[model samples]
Target chain A: MGKPTGFLEFHRELPANRTPSERVSDWEEIHVHVPTDTLKRQGARCMDCGTPYCHTGKLIGGMASGCPINNLIPDWNDLIFRGQWKEAAVRLHQTNNFPEFTGRVCPAPCEGSCTLGLNDDPVTIKSIECSIADHAFEEGWIVPDTPGTRTGKRVAVVGSGPAGLAAASQLNHAGHTVTVFERADRVGGLLMYGIPNMKLPKSMVERRVRLMANAGIRFVTGVEVGRDITAKSLLSDWDAVVLCCGAAQARDLAIEGRNLSGIHLAMEFLHANTKSLLDSSLADGAYISASGKSVVVIGGGDTGTDCVGTALRHRARNVTQLEILPKPPASRAPDNPWPQWPKVYKLDYGQEEAAALQGADPRAYSIQTKRFVGDESGQVREVHTIDIEWKKSPDGRMHIVELPGTERVFPAELVLLALGFVGPEKKGLVHELGLKLDERGNVVTDGEKMTSVAGVFAAGDMVRGQSLVVWAIHEGRKAARGVDRYLMYGQSYLP
Target chain B: MSDAIWTAGEVPHVLFVGDESGCRDELTAALGAGWAIQPANDGIHAMDLLKHPNRPASIVVVLDLSMPVLEGFGFEKARRADSELSHIPVVLVTSHAADERVKKFGARAYVKRPIVVGDLAAVVRELGEG
Candidate 1:
């Protein structure tokens, strides 16, 4: 490490955010940029621990604890401290194809496993990495690396989300002609539409896409391989096909009045809102609005938080987010220690915004929506809800049980179901290709990441179901190695 | 030719249709008074409102590209096929501004979110007048 005494000299410091009151007035990102000097200081805090658990990427307590992609955290942090930003970017790109996306959205499990965090604060690894990546973009250090020679073999990657992008980038680097097929009008699936612009600006996504295009990766949009172009056609034209289609199917709340006019899936709300915002601002009502309405958001996850933040920005008269689970402890529990993801209560941006305007956190823990109560006109007016209590079953597993006399009516002109996704939609390409599916309905692949069909592989949410973007990139890279071995040696390279 | 009766401090009605509820709320709050707002949870309901004989005149439809049971694109295609709803202007809102589909589909314009309300309202006002 460049600065041996850096951790002793500097305490961990992250970039401050705009005050909640000032930021709630608009939809811009809340976190302000930390000056280069402050970021360098934060980077210097990397301890260069002997074990370096930050990059170990092991699963602790059934949750990811470190960098799944094994990003060279200490190396990059040291590079940033030494003013070697160009080298830091190079090291960052070695493991991650899109640090920009992860820097903004990833939970940064690396910090959780940081050695410095055991005693004091973690080395602001996430912030330092983002700063280096952003600096690289500004200095024109990040550019497309075109293959030295064309391999003549062609590969078709379905979906243009992170997994597909990573896979395509790697395979193209291996000198193979790669074409990414997207059902939507654009390539970056969730990155393009599901994620809001404030979190990840579309300009950044387009910038990388433009560079990839320049590198000879052909992005074919508005093409649904199953319907628009048959799967059979893909097998005939391309030597290999990679199914990176994300878990696009959302889980629905099957309850009374489920067909009400105002009830919607969280992705439906997020996808539409992003589309409207991208289309022509508020000129076209491509998204749903919550102005002067009482909004009820179901489920309590990142997607739900996104809904809460979006609703608060709409100036909803009232907003309430319902979570079936009990609120987490404010600090890490005894069982949850260092090097494990701290399952503690922390306010995300959306909740922070909602709290600023609504005078309290919008979330209602241990509550479940029973039904949608609609007006005579069939528009949703309210939601019937009940408080639930968790009880340990005979087997010591937790189960939700409704509490008596805890029923209440919540006014809700707009209701968003923020429950997570199930799996990729099986119709169209999946059904046409007849890909093998696991018991849970996710695409089934062997340890080699190969589907039942020959020369066909799957990765990302398509195989693993809905998961973090970092995991998707990891699977994509691993699957690319598997594909490379299959193409060259007719065997699997993944161990 | 005649002045349309409007709610006090209302600019004009702008209807948002799609699924993500949070984003809709943010847009509405940001665009407060710059535009009156209505939201449909999905595409079928939005299409029904657009085709209604008593439909709010001069209202803009902000359409999301994806949805269950009649997504924004499907609604747009169906609206284009309908003689009554076809004239209404649709500003396509999306996460993917650079997606080729936006260009091919010929939306009135594309706007990215989470956008500042002032910027969003300005775009709506421009389209409303035109």
Candidate 2:
């Protein structure tokens, strides 16, 4: 409520993005920074409702309706309205461990739960959050906060993804000597490899990782917890060990011609592409080439969209995404009202690029692939598909029903499956520790986030299954708190 | 507060137990289905609506689970414990499909949200059948 008429005076405006033509040619982020003046006006648009729904963080309708980490939305909005940059950054960091990662990647459930969204467009909370973080970096407000005293306790974090990094950072803050072990050649797991340079530039990940290193947190890359080093040794050496290894066991499509040469998991395609791009500027001849090929990506989530964008960057001849469900409505449906995460159709960055290069959106809704038709040499060259409709069951549940006489095929040389992850791979460290997994294959933890074993804690995707980056950070922070309590006998300093 | 309550109708009631937009429109659609709609800003208000006799006899309590004051789960618990209100069936109207978790909370049926008025009416009629 900075300006009584602020919501009326200034309409919602997002910061400008680089033209698709300019951005798709290179591996850089699409968004351009908006000046402080525009941000202040956007901040003014926040009604600051008596009970701001933007930070409630409740799981409404199975999706997060607000900030998962519960960032103080109104406080930061007010700070921006009052021209408090450093204070805003500090407030932003109070709840969130890293807003930079979220600001760039999170789907912004906060905006969906905004009170103004009841009638008018919601305030640009995500943009404001990103601006605060970027401004903090530019002003040199972001620096290492090494603990003044030592706790004489050691913790080994199993993964170097957001969860592990956040846990390590928080544990370091509590004066516990912390070490992060990453299986990958570089520190970041999904952040470094799964996501492309266009969505989140590698420099940002490196910058944050470097800052954490400067803060006295030790990082050891290429040292896997179960293989390079034994889990028993890690458990014996460290006072407490927290497992943050993510759920990466991807869901696969089992069909005829599944053994074709061209079909690959979305992560494999994305990981190899990113590693090559980073290692030798794509001169290494390592990644699955989508160039001069008609690619059919078999999912419609963030990963599939990333594949589409990656293929476009590699100058693919054509690309199509097959979505099993029908296209979502352009506007929020009645059941998907405010504060319940509006399930409206939105064109993401990759979809936008595809639309710009091609004449239409690359997705085909209500379609299911039956088989992978291959060429003479066993390389996939075509995909067989059929249209479908949803039918209600006796239990009143909706199920996909294939339409009659709608079978068709597309010429596809490269096929990527982005059907999402099943759960954490229950192979290495998990088996070594004899960790108890839930029915869904995720590690089972108690109220204290500790596994069945004493002095061993678990967090993030390994425990909760595949989830968003924000949840990983939240779980990491929670796990850090649990680890601290176990070390200090119910007294903990982790926030 | 007065607009959210109406005592004149003989239609079966479906209490919308949340204050957000999804709750509002669902209740409004319930009214269109010839059912008396009771609006409670949160679970606390919902509990208040269920206790009084002047209110219509509610057949199904549609829950949003994301209310501010008293959560959807807590509200269902309080309802189940009460001798007078325990028998009333609940239809969980949420974005995600209702699953075993909803059944644990005493929900009889569910309508996946982004809800169509007709679909909700159909489910309510089916679940509300004698």
Candidate 3:
């Protein structure tokens, strides 16, 4: 617990983000550094209840209501209140393998489930969590904790995303020889390419990968499991195999004129922008340029917001995000009670930046794209859309009804589909290994996270479909335990 | 729970232990082809479906925590007590997060409220295949 009267004495506060006009100009992080005193006072506001739901890591309303990895949140919050930054970092790392990544990208479900949120604002848990990790890094508290003794077994991890990395880290710490196979030229899967640098600096990903490598974890980049080497070969070579290959199959809007030249998946636009930016600082001109173009981003999710932000950074003429779902309420509805993730509307970083620059928020809610109108040259020129209403039928099933005479068109040269992912790509390693797929096309796993094959296990988005990075880490850790137990004759020391 | 086996049509692959509402049809549609869904008013009806001798070979039970007769926990207790049905996987659906005790009850996974079709389908399919 924190200070007894801390919640009463102090109000919840967070460090102000960098001015959108300023931060959007460069690829630097959006947050402005907060003073240690301010962070400490903020930490003191935690009212640790008799039963803390912040670390329950439970799913409510099909969404994460707390920390997915179940970080000892109160302990760390108390530690931070006492100004014991190092101890806070230790408590964080005990559960989350990479607080640095989560501290940046996580939507802070912990805050949503904070007991204090029942009345007043919740504790500034996310900012405090981030500050603890950042402080640890600055003071050199984080390092490669190589195991003293090595187990004779070897494990192979496919897809070096959050899940793959978490599994690899845990397995290596358990004294097993671990090899992480990544298809990308760089180490991180989504961390490297899927996310923009401004959100999660590539250096952070590289730093962690470097530490793991130093701890004797072999990273083989640019090697596809089913293509570079056969999945059968990996199964034969390693004592156990874990599939951390993310659910990368992006959902498509296969409407009319989908084959137009300028239409691109959100990942393609993001991956190239980051790669080119990192590779040559955009001087090489290898990315799909949004410069001087009207950008239309379909699907109003985090990925869509990222596209909007990136398009703004590229100095797009204009940007608009089309969301098929109705706008959420400004405050939590009666049904979305305490300890449940409040289904409320709030502008994300990208939307904030867009609003700061543009006259209005760049989101068009309850709209559906009819078709992409392309020119004779096959370059997408405009996006046709119509407003829609959502109504629950007599049967209690929600259905979309297109509104009449509400058609609108927006000029666009670039159409980014941020409609989210379907599931793991089934063509390569998943197919080669003959793994069973769920109805939604995610890899099917048993209770132990083991796939249909005895020696092979799957985790993360690959098994759970497209999900948060925190959940990926959770899955990765679980799969590591499963793999360890199998290799050690139904015994495992991994937590 | 009755021991009467299903005789007509295909024995349902899933025993949905929850309210008799739109969720069953929604789940059935979301589960797509090959999955035949049979609804239960509560845990009691679910037990009867489980006890059927002609139940599908790869059947799974999707239970809701808050229900009328023989709730999810109670059904789990009775199901686990039976040696023949103990190994079958059960996925729990709830509006709030279930505590760690659910894992001790042998629930394979949890699907929260405001259910996403894809997510529920994935969990049920994985548990069914298991």
Candidate 4:
């Protein structure tokens, strides 16, 4: 909007990334930073459309196509283009508490729904947004805003992921004494452990945590409510308790040899790998190492791709990825039009790395693992697989049918199961709390995002199943509003 | 099976177990003729082949985590329990990337399905060198 013809003058461009070959050799980020001058041009590309669909945060085609938090994209873009970076940061922070995290790891549905992308490429809103927030950090502009006055009310935020962080930040800003409880050794649940450093660096998470700490948000790591501390005790101690614990349970493969040695969950590998790297500079054998072994990754999704990339860095003997679904079309299908989330196939960074190293993409589509084969010593040695065909059953539900005579064997010294998660772990915490679960096993909540129990609220992956980080932040912000309204008007303000 | 160079000398001999023909064909093509290719129809046959005296001395074994007769974790447990095959390095491959059960089993390497021929060969070479 700053420049009337800016969109016409400049094309959309993203920061250059390290070549797949070079990036696969180490556990460093693949993207390289673009210069401020170039970033400014990208920011200027925002047309400041009258009806900016990018910020609507609506559901289209059963998928979120815009910013879930409804980030003020045009406002921040204009501010950034005008060189008012400090103002841009403030504008970005108005809606999103952690733009830096989203800017790095988010899939950017906002860009997908961008009006600019209707015909041409979308404006580089995400990159510009990230740059503005990162620049603010560098300039020390993102200082903690301690509440001037303290409200008598105290709030307890369970879980320290994006949702918990947002709830705590908002509650603190509202002058409530907010304390965040995290079960992990460190705060930033998924941000700290679930996601690898190469993607969302732990330093970024720590930097934000430090700021939140200065803002009167007390983050109590290793303190799990409902277990270490009782939910009843927390309710008695605080004016309100918000449950933001994310979904921590991984979906399992219940095939024949599920209990075999050498088969592992993707999160187990990723979490341990990150913990080891953080703890001992990669000296400890705490992480699952793919070095000097043939590796097979199951489930072709972001997690699987991450495993592929991580294994390549470890110099594994070989890598193979299997997916049950049929291969996606190279381009968007007729059903998937513009402004809808494209259901097309694209190589992610990890796949690119695997392809570069092995001279081919490491994905097998329409394949299903039948069982795990063990060696004489009871260690997993091979996997039995069969081809599957999708068919519509009499009930009209899609089901997979194993093809005839398509079975084969593949060697796998190590198997990292990258299957998706089921729901939040319902063990010590959830069981003790006695929270009601939905049909899908997620924490059940009403229209107010509050659980059946009074004075208690739920949000993020704990309420939803395993989901994107962006959605978690969105739910967290909404849940904070719900908690605030609940405290003041005895009802939720979330729409 | 094609008249290609089997660089078995430089490349590690690995037995691939699974029922997907495409994956096996792709791996054979990717590893090229340099490495010895042994395919097993099911877990039982794979185990039998591993115990056979004529079987090539493979330092590394690439196995799928899910299979019949003995699949994934079952095969790994069986292999580790046996005094003969416990020492061989094993890799578990599957389509489920983040299954915690696989991680709990302690596979040396966890490979996702839809094997990239080149990446598989590179990993195999690295294991051989190790």
Best by lDDT: 3
Q: How do the candidates rank by lDDT, highest first?
A: 3, 2, 1, 4
Q: What residue runs in model 2 are displaced by over 4 Å at the alpha carbon?
A: B1-130
lDDT scores in order: 0.83, 0.86, 0.88, 0.81
Off by over 4 Å in 3: B1-130
Give the per-residue lDDT digits (tens) of candidate 2, residues A1-495. Answer: 677678999999999989877888998898999899999999999988899899988998899988888899999998899899999999999888788889888889999999999889999999999999999999999998788765567899989888898889888987788999998999888989998999888888999999999989999988887889999998888989999999989999999999999999999999999999999999998999999899999999999999999999999998899999889999899888888888889899888898999988999999999999898999998999999998899999999888889999999999999999998887778898899888888999988789988888998988988888998998999999998777644556467
Considering chain A alone, what is the TM-score of candidate 3?
0.99
Candidate 4, residue A313: Cα displacement in angstroms equals 1.7
lDDT of 2 at A259: 97
Per-residue alpha-carbon lDDT of candidate 1 for residues A75-180, written as tens digits (9 for 90 to 100): 9998988899899999999999999888888889999899998888888888887788788999999889798755456899988899999999888887678999
Model 1 misplacement above 4 A = A490-495, B1-130
lDDT of 4 by residue, B1-130 (tens): 0112223453457777777778777777777665767776555456656666565565567787666434556566667877888877876777777777876877767677676767777777677567
Lowest lDDT sum, 10 consecutive residues, model 4 chain A, at: A486-495
What is the C-alpha lDDT profile of model 4 across A140-232, one tens digit per residue? 999997876554468899999988898888878766789899988888988988888888889899999998899888889887787789878
Model 4 / residue A229 / CA error / Å: 1.6
RMSD of each: 24.4, 21.7, 17.9, 31.6
* Comparing 1 and 3 on TM-score, the stronger one: 3
